[model samples]
Target chain A: MSALLEVEGLVKHYHVRGGGGLFGAPVVLKAVDGVSFAIPAGRTLGLVGESGCGKSTTARLVLGTLARDDGQVMFDGEPVGSVRDARWRSQRRAMQMVYQDPLSALDRRLTVGKQVMEPALVHGLGAAAERHEKALSIMDAVGLSSRFFDRYPHELSGGQRQRVVLARALILSPKLLVCDEPISALDVSIQAQVINLLVDLQEKFSLTYLFISHDLKVVRQVAHEVAVMYLGRVVERGDPEALFHAPAHPYTQALVGAIPTPRTRGRARAALQGDPPSPINTPPGCSFHPRCPRAEARCRSEAPLLRPLDDGRFAACHFPVLSTPAREAA
Target chain B: MTVPLIELKDLTVDFPVGGNWVRALHGVSLTIRRGEALGLVGESGSGKSVTWLAATKLLPAKARIDGEVLLDGKPIQGLTRDQMAGVRGKRVALIFQDPTSSLNPVHRVGTQIAESVRLHRGFDAAAARAEAKRLLDRVHIPSAARRLDDYPHELSGGTNQRVMIAMALAGEPDLLVADEPTTALDVTIQAQILDLLAEMRRETGMALVLISHDLGIVADITDRVAVMYAGRIVEEAPVDALFDDPRHPYTQGLLAALPDVAGPRRRLTAIPGQVPNPAALPPGCAFAPRCPAAISGCVTAIPSLDAVAADRRTACFRAGHATPWEIAA
Candidate 1:
């Protein structure tokens, strides 16, 4: 199957005033630097990273909400150069995004039903009666009752509000959905409900998803493939089951080991130390060298490029774990 | 058992909303032995936090608390405000989830720590500053003395949480209550904080009451665990037993709902409905509507917590029968 979305060499930087003086140079913070990935049609690509790891920035760039400093984004075999282009406007109808906070994403003044139907109205897809019917059907699919149609956002619970958000996003019948921490704000039981809904919706609609989240468990459940990001770069990418079970990169190993599992109690594992270094002054060579447990002198001078392994996985590490003997012998 | 360090007997808290009172806690009873780590696991509005807040007399004046709270075998429920203040920092220290908001933003983190030391330990200004540095060092903050002078904003969330731990440690209290202490932290940072808390408990032999919604976290840290649903704890057992064979339907559902990292991909057994509203809880067992194993009798009568084994207690109508595990198999 052809890829639904392809991002190449995506870069976004922010300039801020330095501490020198009035004539001081501005510091360039590379929020997303040289990141590239692709999501096949009807599949999910999970992006897992820490808080400042630029996963959200990549989402914004893909959605054209934030202008990229440099890169090419190909959607449906068409290169998107500018957001203002007529093609970009029409392409947006095939892409929709769900945010982390449902309340903030929704307007309190508008009723839940109207909010869900607004997308259809904006795209001028149908008349008022048709839009209303579409909204009700979508809401029903997301497990929201018709009674919630006239209720304000505050009247609904957190789970109900999120269903409304999902209903709104799905109302557009977008082929690609960019969900950013969609269930992080929910309770455990409710989080499971939403995750199950996303899975069922994906199967029913054959949707493509670029799921960005910090929760490893939820990501493992929904993602066909996973990408581990560190300081605005994809350090590793592979099948979720393979990547999680036998992580190649040291960073990926640490992340997989750090998740608190109920089965393992009092089992000790090496944890990555210290907070991520400031994005404003990313370290030389590998940006993750400061916290990498197996950093060598070579890692400090030469940056490691992401290379494919024999198992069809990619990792950017000078000495990746579990390498084949032939490569090590070389 | 040598008079438990802290014991809460049938504690209930009610808050007025609109015209009627909402029962936030429906007679919660728990006991923490000296140096024991008891995990309280529950969803939002499940009374895990309220149980501690009411026990410590930290709730707002509008809240009406009933039942008994004993600290060191002494009644703490009837204590006056002045007397309760003495019990707060000196005997029991409470740490919240968000350390950034809990710490005073304007003051240097050192000054905040020093103030707590001075208030609880009766130390002089110079002594308090020295003790603050020591406490920061104890929590593994790098360059403890230098970080003491930095404001809250200057530190990362993990570091700010360390400062909160430092302040909580300033009192050298016998019991530490940490409510979702690592919820806002990154997974790696969360591991660091959990390790620090475990180390502190080991060193000080201080009893810990860890309240969190994450079952995995609770299993990793606590010796015993309590599963709370609605406004009451449905099950209580040693952490291993609770994870291995959960008796209550809610507890079983919660464990089954979690997506496993090591296991094969499968559909999650999500609980059907949301948590019941505290203000208008249904009669009898509040969890009946969502309980897969609920019976007709469960809808008319509340199940009291009954001992199922040596140290396990479950509040289910069919606790002794084959549980959800057997049913699923």
Candidate 2:
């Protein structure tokens, strides 16, 4: 299977002024230190992590909207070029990103139909009438009615607005769609409606998704493969079912357990302790060691590398959980 | 038996819209016992927050409220502003979703907490400040002494919420109304805050009302759960009972809507259509338009919240074996 998109050793660093004013001190913020992932054609890759764990940064890097300090991003067997390159602009139509906030993503002044056609209009794909026809057809595909064609963003509900966003992204018929917390802003019932729509659209359009969300449940449902990131690094990557059933990395275990499921009261104690450390001054050795339940003496000074387990899953932990017999061989 | 710590009887609220009144809460009746952990689950504009806001008389003066709010079986609805002030923060502290915006940014975290202490406890500046430090420590904010002088912006979101909880605790209220308190924090931090709230409840024996849209959190934490929709509570039951056997169609739909984190994967059974506009609500049950179990009578007559069992109550007319329960009632 050929990967529609492949990212390796992605790193983006930012220089920030430490706590105090101008002359206080210069600090390095490694927003996305080193991340790697690949999404096969028509399959989804879920990126799960806490805020400031560089999930969003990784999304932008994959799309080339943000310049990377060092890395390689390959899309459809070709290395993606810098933002200034002509090839980058040409390839932009093949990749689309759906943002978290639908209200902010759409322009309030424009009609929903106008907004849907904006991407095609910007790319100079067709005549005005052709774009209009294309926009209405795309709207129908995303479950939006013709009555909403003239309606402004404010006129629509959160779910409808999200459909507009999805319609706009799909108008160009991109191979890879990057959705970052797409349903987080919606209500629960509305969230279900959108999720179901996403699934239907994925099948109909044969779209490959790089789905980024902090919600483990939603991710588990939508993604075939999942990557668990902590402090700008991938801690574990494997099949969502296998990985979530019993996580190898301690951080992954803690994250999976932390979600408040609806069935029953989980363990009395919180699986993980404390909060994620500041990305600017991340802890030495393993970034998760401070909050890790199975931290040892060596974990304090030596960072772990992401290596494949016996079941084809990768985990960046020295003492990965040995719940499965096959894992001992790793 | 001792009277419940707080009770709201037939509470109703309406806000005047462009020419008509939009009813936000419709005859909400609920009670909270001493040291009870109650969960209020609902979608946006579902009246979960409005129930408390109206009960506490925190809604704006323009909004009309009709209800009886009782504290220890004593009607507090007729209390004067000065008396009501005592009920609000001193007797029932409130924390909102966004801790950063809820707090006064210019004020130091400690100063805000100390002011709350001074207002509620009538403590001197020194005593209030000292108590503020202790409260912060209780909420598990690290380096409590150093964080005292830091502005709300200087602290992380999780730390600021800890300060808010500390400030809420300054009143030492019998009931703490946390409205989506951990919604803004990260998953790990959310866990920490939930653990903190649970620990505090165990230690202090204070009742808590957790208002959130997240069913998972509500199911995990609360002893009892109330599921609301379109300004009405469609179902109320013991936490386990509600999860085990939901009666209302809306309640069932909500549970079905949630994608499972573990176990088998299944297609989501999302409810059809959007929540009806509150101002132009249907003459019948507000949920009938989207309910799959809706019957012919559902369009013509409203369903009152009827007792389904000794411990469970539902507003749906077709709530499992509704005919038998109707005769029993």
Candidate 3:
């Protein structure tokens, strides 16, 4: 499958305030610094990171909602800077997004059926009767009853509202779906239902996905491949099973270890000493060196670029872990 | 092993909404032993938070509470407002979910913690500040004294949570009620905070009543677990047994819906309905509408928690013989 969406050397920076007044020195926070990735058709690539690591910014950039300081976002083998171009406009129907908070994403004044039909109407897909029929079908597909067609947002539960939001996104039948923490705001039982629905929808439609979330467990369950982001860079990328079982980078190692598992009790963990450094005025070398457990002298001055390993995994650390032994291999 | 730290019998809390009363808790009874962590697991609007809040006398003015809240077998129901205030800060401390909103934005974190200490313990300003720093140090906040001077806005979310925990501990309360304490934090910080809570529980022997929506989190630190649905405890059991063999239909549904942390790709089984609204709850078992094993009989009557096994309680009519546990592979 050819790449449906490719983000090449993407860079996004925000000019933030310093301690002093307007005359004080200006500070730049590199929210998404040279982050690169690609999503092929019918595949799910999970972007996993803590909050403030620029994962959301990268999503915004891919969705063309944010202006990049420097970089390229190629949609359908074409750049995406000026979306008004006919090529971009035609390809726009091929992409859609499902936001995390359905309460904020949906318009309260509109009915569920109207919300789902908006995309169909925007693309001039069909007539009013046909669009209404399609909206009801979409709602049913997402597990929303037809009774909710006239209900407002306040009348529905969080799960039902999210399903309405999902129905709206799927109405266009986009090839690529950008899900930004779509299940985080949901209850656990509801979360499982939504995730299962997404999986089923993906299988039915053969949709590619850029799944952005901070939940490692959820990512492991759904993602075909995974990318670990830190301080606005992809620190590691590999198959979900391999990376989660025995992560390569120390930061990944710390992250996987820090997760509280129900199977075991009170396992020892290498607690990160301090919080991540400020995005503004990042360290000279590795942006993570300040909080890295295995930082060396060279790490202080040299940033490591992502390099492919023997097993087709990519890691951006000078000292990647030795290959997992037979016993530890998942 | 001896007298439980906190006990509630026939606890009921009702909120006045327009003119009618919305029952948040319905005749719920529970106990927390000293140094024990009791996990209260439920979906949203399940009344897990309301139960504990009423036990600690922290409910808002609109709530009318009825029950016997026994702290070491001492009834605190009829205590005056001043006496209840004394019970709230000194005897039972609360650590809220959102640390950002819980702490005052303008005050220094140390001063906020010191204020709690001063309000309950009556320490002088200097001594309270010193105690506040010590509490922060105990919660593993680095450079506690210097960091205490920083305002809430200047601290990170995780640090602010640590400061909240420090404030909760400043009064040396016998019971700590942490309501979704780590929900707003990242996973790494969440792990650190859980570790801190575990360590504090061991050292101080303070009974902890933890309210959260995550089953895995409650399973990690809690000794026993209570599953709440709509406003009642549907199932209560030892941690291992609850996971190994959940009896109630709702409990089984929750377990089946949870993604197995260690497994290949599989479709999760989900219960097919939304949680019933608290305002207009169903007449019978609240979970009957969503329970997979719900029979015709279940919809006609509310089930009381019955002893299914040693120290295990389940409220479903078809609990033990009706619902069989399935471990996700």
Model 2 ranges with Cα > 4 A deviation? A324-330, B321-329
Candidate 1: give the clashing pairs.
none
Q: What shift in Å separates residue B85 of candidate 2 from its native position after superposition?
A: 1.2
iRMS, all models: 5.5, 4.5, 2.5
- TM-score of chain B taken alone, candidate 2: 0.96
DockQ of each: 0.55, 0.52, 0.55
Cα error, candidate 2, residue B71 (Å): 1.2
Instruction: State the displacement of the C-alpha of residue B19, model 1, in Å, after optimal TM-score superposition.
Output: 1.7
Taking every candidate in turn, the Cα RMSD to the unseen true structure, in Å, is: 2.9, 3.5, 2.0
Tens-place lDDT digits, model 2, residues A1-330 = 879899999999999998777976999998999999899999999999999999999999998988999989999998886666878877888999999999999999999999999999999999999999999999999999999999999989899999999999999988889999999999998998899898889999999999999998899888989999898999999998788887899888778777887753544544576778889999889988988878998888999999999989999999998584211111
| Residue A67 alpha-carbon offset, candidate 2, angstroms | 0.6
The residue-by-residue lDDT of candidate 1 on B194-271, one tens digit each, is 989999999999989999999989988899999998879899999999998888888988988888676667778888
What lDDT is reached at residue B161 by model 3?
89
For model 2, how does the per-residue alpha-carbon lDDT over B34-124 read when each residue is reduced to its tens digit? 9999999999989999999998889999999998989999999779999999887888999999999999988898899999999999999
Select the stronger candidate by lDDT from 1 and 2: 1
Q: How well is candidate 2 docked (DockQ)?
A: 0.52
Candidate 3 structure, TM-score to reference: 0.96
